[model samples]
Target: MPENTPYSLPKDSKAWQQAVDSIASLLPEDISLHDFDALQSLPVFALIVVLPAKVPALDIHHYVQSWVDEQPSWHLVTVAEDAEASFVDVDVATNGSTGTQQPFTPAQVFRYLLVPVTDTLMHPGKKTAAAHIIDDQLTTRLRHDLAKNYANAQATDHPENAALVHDNLVDCHILSIGHMLRTHKLACFDMDSTLIEQEVIVELAKTAGVGAEVEAITEAAMRGEIDFDESFVKRVALLEGISTSVLDEICARLTLSTGAHTTITALKALGYHTVLVSGGFSYFANYIAKQLGIDEVHANHLDIEDGQVTGHIQLPIVNGAKKAAIAQHTAEHLNIEMSQVVCVGDGANDLPMMAIADLGVAYNAKPIVQARADAAVNVTGLEGVLYALGYPALVASKS
Candidate 1:
């Protein structure tokens, strides 16, 4: 086995054949072809490493493999690399007969780095001729150990991307082949600070002559110093008597988060059912959802009377609890399991839904949000969310 480098997925058709040969080597000389069925039933995991496009494919395999070495329990069966992500087979996950496939354990989840590594690194090497190989069943202990390794990896920084800020780490994530084969059908996102770059409520407050008060209250809510419902009520009350036209004016000037269009397009193309679930007004969530091609929206409705802000909310405010309920109902209605539900947001209120989601994403979120979510994306754009969902160009080369 190589000292540091770990195994990676096959890069192309030729390397893929070599990988099959490695498995064949484990069989006895007189083993019959009928025994191949056992291999199919055996669990398999791909240590998908997504690097910045500028980085050489070989470095990506090496960078992640090195980290895998630190984990004592698992071993690379074989190592190969590719410049493009394997055909995800998006249709294969959602369409056709899936009854035959074995169900993955709920403990098994799709995990990834929020921001992929870039051209720079502290230790760069190539895939080696050998790997720290191991053959073990998918036992409960192994599963628990692998999960622990993932947590350790995230807390431990990569050789590169250890910058104080403006960093991208060689973050390695594991997902069972079973989970990977299931279609992630629903995508729920918070409107303010997520789809769009600004907070719609704060924008409305600025126009309503309550900008300072609202911003202060919003910051306090994020800081967990005040309750979301109370802060929201106080903030909205300050916007009383504002013209309804202000809603349209604020929506027109807001900018979508960087790489938002690309991320949403990629999700839709992959056949995901996109939904906007925000604590902000339906007025803004609906507008942004339309522009991004999102399928549905759930948000708090702001009350207006005589073409002016009434500063009152309709019943059932969409707080953290409501967000989780919405996500749960959406999954049930769509016939998708909670394992296929993904929630992305950037504030304290978004945490509840994230907690219940299959994959919780904190996008350019506060430090506390980043600490708690399944994954956090602060250095990169909205496209980083795609990486968390197994969409990055996981590159590699022949070992």
Candidate 2:
């Protein structure tokens, strides 16, 4: 009612227009407004404004406090820079009365865990048990329950003893959270030993009768014990005398890792631009991409001569650095920020691309890869990623 107070005005009111205009005018020229919403459920008037990132000089607290000095019951406001950040209002009634109220801070800490669905059904208390280990006061929400018998949980106020909590849960596979979980747009995957169950080259080697030799090289390279390029050349040389038809046989037998299809389907359905970047040959990556309906594919090309393997690969191999570059290039092409990309792989070479992505998930990865990744998924299949992104069980099931 006072002229100096910050009061709530009707959406159509000129007062509201002036307030919006004033805020916009105060923002820096480079800063852009992303979203603004009025709280409809809250009893008191409140507004939430979303910006791109933190701004040092944009202090709305001082502006609102000055107005509050005049009109005690005017309105409350908050600003958030993170796109996925949200606020939840909590009201507590004292002495069994409903009028008095207090608000708690927004839920900042987030936890992600995976448990066997059968275990959860058999022991429903397991969910509560895991929650207690994180934070007794916090609540856990079901993110996803895969058809493969695993379920994902998201919780607030995650404890500092997160690793201990994960260790306590017998069936729990992954436990991770933070900015990476909230903001990811693209999902990139490595081909060999990641999306698929085995290395295509090793399979080809088996057909060439050099399986033992090639497999050893592949393992050493993936473990980061040997240079990928050097290992690739040695492995390819072993397949030189093998006929090109071996590729068809290998592709026919290529088995996707558990939940690979479901994971890609869910990611695409959620509006992610899926890509397959591999050090493996396009001979296999292209076929897999088509079958999986991936949006993009980048991989090496194996040289062939006279209907047989030439034992030589094309230049500019899709090594770790190349994979990272492709991931960045794809993000630019999609016009999405790098913070929106999620990369998943299993070997050392996949580390570079994973590092560039907002969330790097090691899917049954080697020790070195897992150590460097933002998160690791060992027990569940690829679909576990939906849980990492905080998708609800029902939502992933529907996908």
Candidate that scores best on lDDT: 1
Which pairs clash in the backbone of model 2?
A: 143-392, 143-393, 144-393, 184-340, 185-340
Which stretches of model 2 miss by more than 4 angstroms? 1-183, 394-399
Model 2 C-alpha lDDT per residue in residues 1-399, reported as the tens digit of each score: 111111110111122223333344333344323322121111211121111111111333443344344444333223222223222111111111111111111111122222121211213234224323432111111111111112111122334422322221111222222231244578999988887888998998999899999999999999999999899889989988788877787787787765566567556655679999999999899988876779889999989999999888789988889999999999999899877889999999999988877668788788898666755665455655654554322110111
Model 1 misplaced regions, further than 4 Å:
1-63, 76-179, 394-399
Compared with the true structure, what per-residue lDDT tens digits does model 1 show for residues 115-190?
Answer: 1122111111111101102111222223334334434554465535323221232323343332333457889999
lDDT of prediction 1: 0.59
Clashes of each: 4, 5
Model 2 alpha-carbon miss at residue 371, Å:
1.1
Model 1 CA lDDT for position 153: 51
CA-lDDT, candidates in order: 0.59, 0.56
78 in model 2: Cα distance from truth in Å?
A: 23
